[model samples]
Target: MIMSHPDSIPLNQVLPIFLQVLPLKEDYEESTAVYGCICNLVLSSNSHILSFVPQLVSVFAQVAVSPVESHEVKVHIGRAFSHLISIYGHQIQPLLGNLSPAHANALAAIAP
Candidate 1:
């Protein structure tokens, strides 16, 4: 059996940190940076991100649609969503139906 790289932390470990931090209202800057990092990680190692796709999509959608979030954060979320779709278009299809209207709209704005 082929082993994944030792330096690549398991999704189980990395996801919890994202789940904890992404929803906080008090740290927009930190959360946005974390969101960008997560997107980059997903782009670089999509297989590792597969199990957490639903949560990842939802968190980004939420951020993208949030009126209180800064424009910069929303733009980052939109870019992240675009990157994800470019890499994993089919994988994200089923989850799109489950998104809230605002989330769907946000995604639609960037859809190809």
Candidate 2:
């Protein structure tokens, strides 16, 4: 649905839902899927996502640095960061310093 017409998806509605759910530790698999969905949505609709970059980046950083987060989840988070950086490196560059050491390392590993 989002892929077909990314702009049509109501980010204001969906993002709040994702932000509430994605940080929970109880549903790792579901959270991973949600992260993937977010990555795809941003890739498909960069312009629309630009407005929420700070929030998205913060969530990704949190997930990437979480000590108890699953390896699979971390992989997805890394990929998401890599894609975001690839698409918006200039805008996101300054925010990199704000990330935790672990999160910065994960991003550096996958970033070009």
TM-score of each: 0.73, 0.72
Give the clashing pairs for model 2.
none
Model 2 misplacement above 4 A: 1-8, 110-112
Model 1, span 24-62: residue lDDT tens: 577666765666667666656556665677887888777
Report the C-alpha lDDT of model 2 over 14-92, residue by residue, as the tens digit. Answer: 7676666556577665665666677776666556665677777877777766677777766766776777777777888
Q: Give the TM-score of candidate 1.
A: 0.73
Model 2: residue 19 alpha-carbon error in angstroms: 2.2
Runs of candidate 1 with Cα error greater than 4 angstroms are: 1-11, 110-112
* Candidate maximizing TM-score: 1
Clashes of each: 0, 0
Among the numbered candidates, top lDDT falls to: 2
Residue 86 in model 2: shift from native, Å?
Answer: 2.1
